[model samples]
Target: MQNYTKFGKNININNIEIAVKTRLGQPHETMRNGVMKERKKPGLKKARKASQFSKR
Candidate 1:
């Protein structure tokens, strides 16, 4: 299992689970920006890297 951050919370979109990081009132550009910001977080990046290495 992967650890989910606040920005990468799973949401149901059209019956599919998608990871979104923006607020409901935010614009589309905000969603992109939010994902970019989330990607820059060291903790999240580290967690992702760790998960990848564990899969080997």
Candidate 2:
């Protein structure tokens, strides 16, 4: 038997139980720590993008 804490809740798993085989999957790292947006750089159209060039 094993104990797991998920979403602030306690869960128990038995070696001989089918629930053990269908255990929950872990959340993504970003999800666990919260997602953050990248800051845009100076003198750029976007974060890492620039204006298009025109050659005539």
Candidate 3:
């Protein structure tokens, strides 16, 4: 089951919780090269792809 916190800053899936943490104040694409972009979690990435495929 997926649930959101009161403020909706993070997400809880099954028993694993993942927070939507962003880099700096702006998106990484907008920055030149301050720091490497935040890599997406493998499990979350896979789940996202699966959800997209299911939507189609």
Candidate 4:
């Protein structure tokens, strides 16, 4: 069988089974990564980060 572990292809079936059992089968959550990125706010520099200000 193909190696599902991220380590390498030298892994055995037992190790693969254990990895699957432990829920480490695949690294990526889904086929498309970062598809649901948070939208930046209208006023904020970033999504939630605002510009820094200082009082003289």
Question: Per-candidate TM vs. native?
Answer: 0.32, 0.19, 0.36, 0.20
Q: For candidate 4, what is the lDDT? A: 0.41
Candidate 2 residue-pair clash tally: 0
Q: Each candidate: what lDDT?
A: 0.43, 0.33, 0.42, 0.41
Candidate 3: deviation at residue 28, Å?
Answer: 11
- Report the C-alpha lDDT of model 2 over 1-56, residue by residue, as the tens digit: 34433322332333212332334432222222333223344756553353344321
Best model number under TM-score = 3
lDDT of 1 at 16: 20
Cα deviation of 4 in candidate 3 (Å)? 31
lDDT of 4 at 31: 16
User: Could you give the C-alpha RMSD of every candidate to the true structure, in order shown?
Assistant: 12.4, 12.6, 13.4, 10.7
TM-score of 2: 0.19
Superior candidate under lDDT, 3 versus 4: 3
In candidate 3, stretches whose alpha carbon ends up further than 4 angstroms from where it belongs are 1-35
Clashing pairs in 3: none
- Model 3 scores a C-alpha lDDT of 0.42
